[model samples]
Target chain A: MITVSIEKKLRTYGGGQALKLAAEFLTGSVTKIYGPSGAGKTTLLKMLAGLVRPEKGKIVFNGETWLDTERNIDMPPQKRKIGFVFQDYALFPNMTVREHLQYATHDDAWIQRLLAVSNMTTFTSHKPAYLSGGQQQRLAILRALATKPQLMLMDEPFSALDTQIKIVLISELQHIFNELATTVLIVSHNLSELESFDGNVLYVGNQ
Target chain B: MDLSPIWLTLKLAAITTLLLLAIGLPLAWWLSRGRSGIKLVTEALITMPLVLPPSVLGFYLLLAFSPQNGLGKWLLHTFDVQLVFSFPGLVLASIVYSLPFMIGPVKSALQQLPVSLAQASYTLGKTEWQTFTCVLLPNIKPSLLTAIVLTFAHTLGEFGVVLMIGGSIPGVTRVASIAVYDAVEQMDYSSANNYSLLLFAITFFMVMAVFIFNKYHAKSPLE
Candidate 1:
């Protein structure tokens, strides 16, 4: 199980406010962070991924205290074993599809499995720039899964794709997650887009 | 054809380019990724050489390398190394002279990289060094190439620093630019013309190649 409890202040433009929340979940369960822009949805995800520090709180994942600001314990992102797929699909431009998979996982068997699951077996030699938007999204998901993390954090993963492509890719992703039993936390403003995924929704807003 | 000076100038340029790359890459990387205050200070220092007149830089270098100075005295006493009137001394001067040429392009390229890439790499269990080498460096290859080429060509055309510190020692520190001046002083106009022409031709071709490659590969940076 993963547990996150954090309190942080958001400062932008000309104002600031504090955010406080506590959440917990079991393995293989998908959790959707539903909120409009500027509601601290991404901030909460970043804190859980160990990319951002909370002013006062604790984050415990799988029995490990990843962050305890009061106790002065803070684990970096790499040690947290949490995969984050960025909104922009931060694939290394210099790396090919096979190399991107290899960067996170050295095992050929896992890479081959990911390629088959993501339908990227045919374009193993192509670079990120050459891939279409939906193709890149699929590759991004496979890249995150290659690390075999206990939890995956996706920030607007399918927002860039067209409606038809988005539906196809989401269905494929749902199948893969079910097969692997990987827990996922997705952040998005679109409620309809996320409704199909079997997950509990966390409605975040100004507090 | 006075090939000796030409040969010495090429050697100096090549060595200075290699040394500048060694020193400038890490310095630029640090400056680009460091805090704003540190970045400001390092940027000011790196550009100081560019702003100062080359002769003034050479004067300070000459003083610093004199046998009486601390660093110079230690080097001479320990290893019999002479900075004034030596090939190595000219190389040191050229490195300072052409530092900005190497640093500017590299720092800009590094700054242009999305912060998310590094953050993503870190989250993927790669250390800072691994991310720098495996991810960042490969992406900034074009900028690194630009830095090396510009520094090398600039060093090839340097004159004032070599004149003050090098003393135009034949078969040792007499680089092409100094040789041109010496040839003109001795009234050997034809030889000076030959050396100047060859230098101009080589530098021209290199700059043109860089421009042409940039034109064709402009879209490559978006990736």
Candidate 2:
């Protein structure tokens, strides 16, 4: 389980708005972070991933202190060991799909399994530029999973997929999460997108 | 035609370009990451060569590295090396003259890349240096090519700095640009034209290579 109480001042067009969030995410549980646009949803995920720092707060993951401002203990993103699916996918243009997975882990078995799970086996030799939107999204998810992170933070992971593909992929992801007992925190602006996710909802609003 | 000047120029340009690549990569990476007063000042100093007259830079470098000056005297006493009016001095001068060309395009491309790319690498447990070399640098090949070719071509065409610090020493300080000047002074129009034509052809091809690389690697609509 991870406990977080972070206060970060996000810059807005008008000025700065302090985003004060205090929450807990249980292990092996899926939590859908639902919010409006510019509601610091992505920032919250970034904070959890150690990609962004909170001005003041403590983030304790599985009883380990990932962040503690009072003690000045802030772990870097490289040590966070979390998988992040960025809004833009963030796939390297030069690397093929298989190479992307290889870069994250040396486990060839795990890489093959991830490619199979994401239905991206045939596109392993293709670079991101040659992949379709849905294919690219799957590659991003597969790349994130290649590391076998305990916590998976996805930012609108299904925004680029078709409905049929989304449903099938969601079922596959759910099966994999169950098998791995991975905790997931997905931020989505669309409410209906996560209807089939069947996870607890955390609606981030103005503090 | 005394081809020694052509060979000397190529040697100087190659050595300077290689050294600049080694220095500029780390310096540009540091400069591109964040903003600060120190970084701003350093960037301004690096950019000074672009606008400041080559003679101005050469004059100060000449003084600083001259055996008569304290720094140069210390160097001469300690290492028995003289920079002013030497081939090493020409290389030093060329590096200073072409620094902006090496750093500018690479820095801009590094800055323009999406921050998420590095973040993704980080979350994958890659170290900062690993991410920079394996991830960031590979993606910016077009810009890297431009920076490298421009630096080489600019170093090839450098004149004022080389002329000021490195006097016309045959097979040593005398490069193609200086050779062109020397030939023109002696009313050797044909030799001057040969040197000028070579430089023009080399620079043109280098620029064309940059254009072709950019065209091939241009990011298509990823969405």
Candidate 3:
């Protein structure tokens, strides 16, 4: 179970204001963060990932208090056990696909499964730059899963891929999620992508 | 052709380049990621020696490291070390003189890195140091090479700082640049010509190698 109630401010076009005004989420199950662009979706994800600190609030995940700014308790991102797939798919450019998958996991079997599931076995030696957009996104997803976190946060993971590749990878992702039972929170402006994801959605907007 | 000065210059360049890399990498990382005000101040300080005449910088360093100064006194009494008119002193002065050559390319390379890369590494359960060594260092290879070559070449050709602090002590602080100057001053045109040609050839080759490598494998910061 994850529970978060955060209040933070952000700078707007000309001035600073309460951009993330009173955001709240209480979920007993895996959830998705569905919102349009500039809707503070990424901000909320960053906060949940422990990358950003809320001005005044608490974030409790799996009975552990990850953030309590009032109490001066803030766990860093590494301790949060939350995996984030960046919008640009921040794969280490220097590492091969196999190394990327290997970085977050100790289980060779699981890595093999991930490579086979993502259909990246053939290009395991290639760097991220050599992979296509869809291939990179698939590698990013698999890399996140390699960590075996309780929750995964993906920010527009498929925004860069073509329609066909997006559909195929999404199905593969659904199968992997079902098999691992890993909770996921994906942020995307694409409503159709959210519809395909088998999870509850957090619709974020201005109050 | 006297090979001693040539050997001395190579040794100085190698030592100076190694020292600069050790010192400059962390300094560049801090400057790249620090707050704007701090960054500005440090940037100005690092580049100050670049724009100023090397003689002026060397003069200040000489005073600071002289036996009369507090640091020099401590070193002399505690460690039995002297900074002025020594090979190590020449190295120390060369490091200061060639600091910007090491820092500039490194700073720019580190600055061009997207914060997302580090953040991603953090999210992957790596500490700041691990991320810096594994991800940041590898990505900035070109810049690191440039820093090494430029700092080495700059130290090889260093004259003012060596002249001011090193005092042309043969077999101790008399590096090739100072030796070349001494040769010219003594009107030993053949030896001076030999040293000058050697320096010119070395610097030309190193600079040419950097440009060629950059041309073939120009790394985009995003990559």
Candidate 4:
């Protein structure tokens, strides 16, 4: 289980607002986070992944104190063992599809399996620029999974995919998430898109 | 006309470019990644050569390299090395003169990269060194190419700094630029014109090579 209580400063057009979040995620469960624009959904994910620092917070992951303001204990992102899919995909332009996975791990079997799951085996030698938008998005997902991280944070993971690809990929992802028993926190604006995942919904912002 | 000066100039530019890569890479990396008061001060100092008069820089360097001074004394005592009016001195002066040309491009390249790439590498359990070498370096090839070519070209064109510190010593301190000045002083217009044209052609070739390589690299499938 993972527990978090934090407050971060966010600057919007109107003024600055405090994004105070408190939540607990059960082990091996997928949690969908939805919010309006500029509601700090991505910030919440970053904070959880130890990429963003919160003004005040205590985050405990499986009894490990990742962050405790009162105790002055803060774990760096490198030690967190979390996978994050950036909104822009963040694919290394120079690295090919296979090279991205090779960068994360040396396990050949695992890499082949990931490539198969992402359906990008044929495009292994293709760089990000040569890949289609959906292919690039899938490669991003595959790269995040390359490390087999325990916790995955995805920001609009399917924003670039077509509806058909999104549906099929999410179905495959559901099985993989279950098999890996990884806790996932995905942020998306559209709720209906996540209907197939069957995860608990956490809405942010003033609706 | 002796072509030794031409070879000497190429050697100096080559050596200076290599040294700048060694020194400037780390400095540029630090300037781009570090956020501290020291970074600001160090950045200003590094950039001083860009704006300062070459003669002024050379004057200070010459003083520092003289055997009577503290730095020169320490160097001579420790290593029995002399710098002023020597080939080593010219190389040192060239490095100082061309530092910004190398560092500016590298720092800008590093700064332009998205923070997420580094973050992604970190989350993959890779160390900072691994991320820099594997992730960051591959993405900044163009910047490295630009830095190398610019530093080499800039070093080739250095005259005032070379003149003030190194003087004209054939096959030693007398680089192509200095040699051209000597030719003009000796009323050898034909030799001066030859030397000038050679330097111009080299600089032009280097710049053109950079443009062609960049265009070809951009068009390649890996891009």
- Candidate that would win on DockQ: 1
List per-prediction Cα lDDT, in the order shown: 0.86, 0.90, 0.83, 0.89
Candidate 4 lDDT, A1-207, residue by residue in tens = 999899888877146887888899998999999988888899898888888888899999999999998899889888998889999888888899999999998999999988887788999999888999999999989988988888999999998889988898899888888988899999998878889997899987765
What does the lDDT read for residue A32 in candidate 2?
91
* Best by the TM-score measure: 2
User: For residues A1-207, what per-residue lDDT tens digits would candidate 3 score against the true structure?
Assistant: 677788877654234544454433443245677754566778888888888777888888878999898899999999987788999788899899999877777889999988887778999999988998888988888888888777788898888778776777778877766666666778887767656766676787654
* DockQ category of candidate 3: medium
lDDT of 1 by residue, A1-207 (tens): 888788988774125766788888777899988865777887887888888888999988778899999899999888888788888888899899999989988989989988876678999999998899888887887888788877789988878778776776678778777777778999988878887888898887764
Question: What stretches of model 2 exceed 4 Å from their correct place?
Answer: B219-223
Model 4 alpha-carbon drift over 4 Å, by segment: B219-223
Lowest lDDT sum, 10 consecutive residues, model 3 chain B, at B214-223
- Candidate 3 — which residues are off by over 4 angstroms? A12-15, A21-28
Cα shift from native, residue A147, model 2 (Å): 0.5
* Interface RMSD of candidate number 4: 2.1
lDDT for each residue of candidate 4 in B97-138, tens digit (9 for 90 to 100): 999999999999899888888888888888888988888878
Individual DockQ of the candidates?
0.72, 0.67, 0.71, 0.66
lDDT of 2 at A207: 39
Ranking by lDDT: 2, 4, 1, 3
Order the candidate numbers by TM-score, best to worst. Answer: 2, 4, 3, 1
